[model samples]
Target: MDIQTILQELELLSTERTKKTYIRNGAHEPLFGVATGAMKPLAKKLKKNQGIAEELYATGNYDAMYLAGMIADPSAMSEADFDRWMGTAYFYMISDYIVAVTLAETDIAQAVSDKWIASGKELFMSAGYSCYCWLLGNRKDEEFDQEKLNKMLEIVEKTIHNSPNRAKYAMNNFVTTVGISYMPLHERAVAVANAIGKVEVSSVKTKCNVPLASEAIQKAVDKGQLGFKRKNVRC
Candidate 1:
């Protein structure tokens, strides 16, 4: 479908309740607040379309931007394209879920994420860590370097508490993901999780506690889900 027709459909799928929830989570105007699940049928129809995805993303509508991620051709996107998208990703959902998730599918995922992680910017760091989480959870353990993951666990242990709110959450998830999904660094990740403890994330609504990586990893262990790998990262 054309962008205009897709946008009209997204508008029709929007609800007041979801709009309020999006606003509460930092989304501004020019959004339809269409639920992610609600976009699946449309996504299925559109598949991967880089041209249309760019148009939708340029609209600056939350739902459109989200749909852009759903249909974007990650292989067609250059590092510059991903960086351009990240530049305008104003919030965690867009940065972590959309930009990072899309980047995870690319061959440059690690290199791009490394630069973002070291960028010292909040959402960039968050998206960078989140991309690792996505990568570790979906890719085979053999694809990662054991030493690199070990160093990352050490970084998380040392800086999680001092990291930005969103980055702290992603960093915590990264540790847990390494523990559960990457057998090479499981023990080190467990130690890092034990050292980091609970992470507190502050927002306008309240101070939320990011789950302890140790506890989350242990739950996966108890369920015999250690060394787990997801079949896909994107919905």
Candidate 2:
């Protein structure tokens, strides 16, 4: 489908409640606030469309940008292309959920994410760690280097508290994901989460919540979901 048609469909699907929720979560104007699940039918129709995805993403509409990620052909995106996308990701919803999730499907996921993690920019660091969480949840355990993941756990253990709020949240998610998905580092991740303890991240609404990685990991364990991996990273 063309950008205009898809955008019109997204607009028709948008609701005041969802728009308000998005606004509360830091989304600005020029957004339709269409729910993620509401976009599935259109996504199923278009499948992968890099050209259309780029067109939609460039519109700077939140729902359009999200649908772009849903239809984007990650294999066709170069690191430069991904970087371009990241540059426009102004908030955590766009940076972590859209750009990072799309990046997770690419072969350059690790290299690009590593650079972003070291970029020292808050949103970039958040997206970097979130990309790793997506990777760990979707990729096979054998695909990762155990030592690299170990060092990342060490990095989180040492620096998560000092990291930016969004990055801290993603870093905590990384620990929980590692504990749940990467069998080789399950114990190490559990230990890291225990050491890190409660992580407080401030929100736009002035509501601060402590995300406990240890609790999240234990919840997964309680469900017997250890070593779990997703079939797909994108919806």
Candidate 3:
């Protein structure tokens, strides 16, 4: 389907009420405020079209950019594409979910993640941590640098308490991903989560709280569901 049709469909699916609700979650205007769940069928229809995704993303509409990430082909993407996407990613949902997921599957995942994290931009750093979460969840233990991950976990343990706004929350997510997705790191993740304790971030009117990493991990463990890796991290 064409971009115009996709956008029209998004508008049909959007509501002013939902737009305001998304605003609370940090969505910028010129968005249809279509929920992520509502966008999946569209993504399925669009499939993975790198050129079209780039076109939609460049429109600067929040929902379209987000959908671009979902439908874009990461295998055909380069570091330059990520750089461009990052420049446009002002929304947390787009940055952390869309940009991060696509980048995490690339061969240069670690390099890109490190560069973004070092930038210390809130969204970039959050996306970087999110990349790590996806990487750890999808890769086998031997495929990555074990020592580096340990040190990264240590960094989270030490600095998560003082990390910037959403970065702390993203770091907490890294801990949860490690605990629930990587079997060998479960103990270490739990320890790190315990040490970090409660994570506080800016409030949403939805009253949704930042989940404690420890409890989140434990819930998975209690259900005998810990250590299972996801087939894919894309939404």
Candidate 4:
């Protein structure tokens, strides 16, 4: 699918009421709000439209740009394009896309890690720390480095301790991403749970629950579900 087709789909699926509600909630201004609502489906579409995704991103839609990073063929992207897109991506998108990239390509792992460290945004930094933990836990090319592991543990601890409520979701995302990458990181995930003083690690467990396209799209196709629209189109 092309960018136009995706945008048309978004317009068809999203109503004026939903858009107004977003505005009412004070989320319409920030670009991430657009992403949180529209970009997931867009990403699914762009998984097959690398060139169109790149073009749409260059048009200055931050949401599209962020989705491009999530769905584009990472190996096909130039280092310059990747760096530019990373510089502009939202924190949460960056966090999630880091997981996608790590899962898909190990050659860019160190570069992605360095970018995550330099992100400076608390959420992004926390995500970087989590991604590094995932790499150590999952990648077989390098043995687990105790010093690096200690550093990640320290950062995770500090992030949880300093901003418990503010960082809760991002922390959960981090743990979830790590768990998805390396199930052995479950112990570290539980440690994150303790540091945040949560009784359960449910959020971490649910963070990586990316449903299949057929399932997610079927939900959208179901009658009475949110975002569902009736039309004569085949899935």
RMSD (Å) per prediction: 0.9, 1.1, 2.1, 10.9
Per-model TM against the reference: 0.97, 0.97, 0.92, 0.53
Candidate 1 accuracy as TM-score = 0.97
TM-score of 3: 0.92
Question: lDDT of each prediction vs. the true structure?
Answer: 0.93, 0.93, 0.86, 0.47
lDDT of 1 by residue, 8-116 (tens): 9999999999999999998998998899999999999999999999999999999999999999999999999999999999999999999999999999999999999
User: What tens-digit string does per-residue lDDT give for candidate 2 at 1-235?
Assistant: 6678888999999999999999888899899889999999989999889999999999999999999999999999999999999999999999999999999998999999999999989999999999999999999999999999999999999999899988998899999999999999999999999999988877656757666889999999999999899899998
Cα deviation at 228, candidate 4, in Å, is: 31
TM-score of 2: 0.97
What is the full ranking by TM-score, best candidate first?
A: 1, 2, 3, 4
Candidate 3 Cα errors over 4 Å, as ranges: 203-209
Instruction: Write model 4 residue lDDT over 1-235, tens digit each, in one string.
Output: 6667755555555555655654443233333334244556666645545677577666454444545545555566655665565455444444434433432344565566556556665544544555554554345523445455445545655764444322344444454444333344445644554554541222322433222322322343353342222231111
Residue pairs with clashing backbones, model 4 = none
Better of 1 and 4 by lDDT: 1
> For candidate 3, what is the lDDT?
0.86
The Cα error of candidate 3 at residue 220, in Å, is: 1.5
Model 2 misplacement above 4 A: none
